[model samples]
Target: MADLQDERPDTGHVPVGPGSLGAEDTPAAPVAGALDRAAALLAVHPVADGCNTLVWTLRQSPYHDIDTPDTGVDTDIPRLRAGGVGAQFWSLLPPSAGPHASGAADQVVSDTLDQIDVALALVRRYPDGLCLALSADDLVDARNRGRIASLLGPVSGRTLTDSLSPLRAFHTLGVRILAPGGAQWAREGLTAFGHEVVKEANRLAVLLDLAGCPPVAACRIAGASKAPAVLSNTAAAALNPHPDNVTDEVLLALRAANGLAMVTFDTARTGDSLHAVADHLDHVRAVAGPECVGLGAAFGAEPGVPRPTGLTDPSGYPRLLAELLDRGWPESDLALLTWGNALRVLRDVEFTARAAQHRRTP
Candidate 1:
C-alpha cells in the first residue's frame, strides 16, 4: 500500500483504496492507512500467546522517499503504529529504483542495499518499537514485548545480483526472508509464472541458497482470471502450464531451496483464474513432500469493492480454509498449508528465534 505503481497499466492489477498509496499522495497518508489496516486485522485475529503474524513491510515503504539521505528517519512508521501496525519491513521494488537500469532485479537489489543507512536510523529511532528483526525467533520476542519487529525481506526475488551481494546486504540489513521472484519474469532461471518469461530465473534460485537468502515461499503465484471460485485453485493446476501459475520447475525451485513455497491467489485476476493453484498445490505436496508448500493471500485490492470473488481480502482466510478442509483435507495438514509451513521455515532461518509451543489442552 506504499507508493507502488504498476509498470503495466491494468485496471485491477494494482488497485487503490482509502488505505492504498501512490508516489503522488502525501507520504503520511499511506503510513496511516497501513497502521489502521494492520491494527484492525490484528485486533480481529490476535496472535495466540506465542504465535506470530508479520505485517508486510513493503506495504508501508513506498511512501517514504526511497532517495532520502537518511532512509532510517521514520516519519511514516509512527503513523503506522498509531493506526495499530506494530511491524513492517522494507520493500524491495525494481520500479522504485527509477527508470533505466541494466537489469530490473539487479537494480532493485542494488538500490535496496543502498538504503541501509535509512533502515539503521529506524532501528535506533524505536529500538523497542522497531528493531532489525532477522529470524522467526526475533518476531516472537518483539511481539511478546509489545514491540514491532521489522523482519527484512525482499518483496520479490528478481533483484538479486550474480555476486549475491544483494543477498548478503539483505541479511546485513536484517531481512529475515525473501520472495525471490516477482510479477515480472526477469532473466533469472526458471522465472515465476506469467509475469515475464525470463530464462535466467533458474540460475538465481540456486544463487539464493548458495548466498544464504533461501526463499521462504514459492514463486508468488497469481491464478488464472477465469479460474474457479473454490478455495483450492484447480484450473491452472496442470503443473504450472500457465506462465502465471507454478510449473513443475518452479515447484522444484522451492523444494531445492528447502523453502516453503506459497501459491498466492489474487482471487480477482481476470486474466488467469486460481483453480490451477489449488490443484497444483495438492500435486506439489505429492511431489515436493508435505513440508515445502503453503498459500499467500494477496487479496487487499477491492475488485469492485470486495467483490473480486466470493471471498473478501485477508479476512476471508478462515472461510477459505473451511472449504479446503471440507474437500477431505486434514486440519493438521491444512494448518501447515495455511500458516505452519511458513512458520517452520522461519524457525530454521538464522537471526530468528523458534516460537515457544503452547501446551495442549487435555
Candidate 2:
C-alpha cells in the first residue's frame, strides 16, 4: 500500500521494491544493505518524527556545514525515506538575533518568514517524497501513500514577538506548534503577555513544546493551561531525579501535569552512546510511563547538536531501535517511543484548536 493517501494529489512516480527514495529514488550502493534492512522494519510499523528533524536550510549556512559532504544538496530526502520515516516535524528556525543580540525585531521576523518560505518550497519541490501534514490523520494518510508527511513548527516562541497576532499569523501559514520559553521553570514563568499567548495557543490548539527546558510552575497550573504540553528535547536530568539535572520536584510536576519528555540523540545531553540514549528513554518511561516518553532526536536539523557515536545520521535511527530492542524493550513500547505518544499529543492539540475554532465560527 502507498504511504500517502488519496486526498493528496499524487506528485509523480510510484515507489517500487525495497528502499524506494521517492521522486529522486536513488540509493547509494554502500548504504543499500542498511536501507534494505530499515525498509523491512518500517513496513511493519510507521515511523513519525516527534520533533524537528528536517532543516535542509542549515546546509546553506557557511558557519554550520553539519552534514557529511557525500550526501550532497538536500540529501536528507533519500535518507529519511530509506530510514522508514513516515512523518516529520520540520522546524522553521529563524536566523534572528535574540533580545540581547544585535539584530532588530523586524529583522528577526524577516528571517523567520524566509525560513517558512524555504520549508514551503521544499514541499513543492518534493511533492512525490513529501506532503504537508496539518493533522494526525494527514500523517497516517501520507505514510499509507508512500510519502513522508511533513509538519512545521517554530523552534522557540522567540520567533513570534510579544503578541498573539504573529502566533495566529503563523497558524494561518500552517504552523501547528510553538515552544514558549518565558514560561520556563528556572525563570519566573510566563509574563502577563506570554500567558495570553499560551492561552491563545491552547485555544488555537498550537502545541507548546518545552524543548527540554526546566518544567515551569505554570505547567502545573490547570485552567490557564492550553493544549497538552510536551518536552520535545531533553536529557535524563530534565525528567528524573538527579543532582545535575532537573530536580525531582520538577519531574513530579511534569508527571502531574500529564506532560511528556521526548528523548533526543544528542550525545552532549544524553552521554556518549546509543546505550545512553536508551538509558534516558528507559528512565523517562520508568518514571513518567510509556505515554509520556517520545522521540525528539532533532537529527539532520540541529547544526551544532552533537549526535551519539555510531549514530552518524538519519540512517542511524534503525540502529538506535535495534539497541533499544537489545535492552529488552517490548515492541509495543518501542512503537510508542518512536511515534505513538507524540501522535496522541498532536491529535489532542489539533482537536482542541479545531473545536475552539468551530465554537467561535458562529
Which has the greatest TM-score? Answer: 2
RMSD of 1: 13.6
Count of clashing residue pairs in every prediction: 47, 12
- lDDT tens per residue, model 1, 216-314: 223332121110011112112344443344445445555554555455444332223223334555676765556765653332221243222322223
Compute the lDDT of residue 190 as modeled in candidate 1: 36
Worst 10 residues of 2 by lDDT: 4-13
lDDT of 2 at 257: 57
Q: After superposing candidate 1, which stretches have Cα over 4 Å from the reference?
A: 1-91, 96-132, 142-150, 155-166, 178-240, 267-280, 299-308, 351-362
Error of 1 at 84 (Å): 15
Span of ten consecutive residues with least summed lDDT in model 1: 222-231
Question: Which digits, one per residue and each the tens of the lDDT, describe model 2 over residues 1-362?
Answer: 23321121122222223233232332222244433443455665656666554554552542432222223322255556544567787766554422223456566667667767777777777788889987888887887788888888754566556556777888888887776643222134666766667667877777777653434533543224656777666667753343224344544556665666777666667776666777887888888787777777667543445566544355446656655665677777777776687778788877777777765531
Tell me the lDDT of candidate 1. Answer: 0.37
**Alpha-carbon RMSD of each model:** 13.6, 7.6
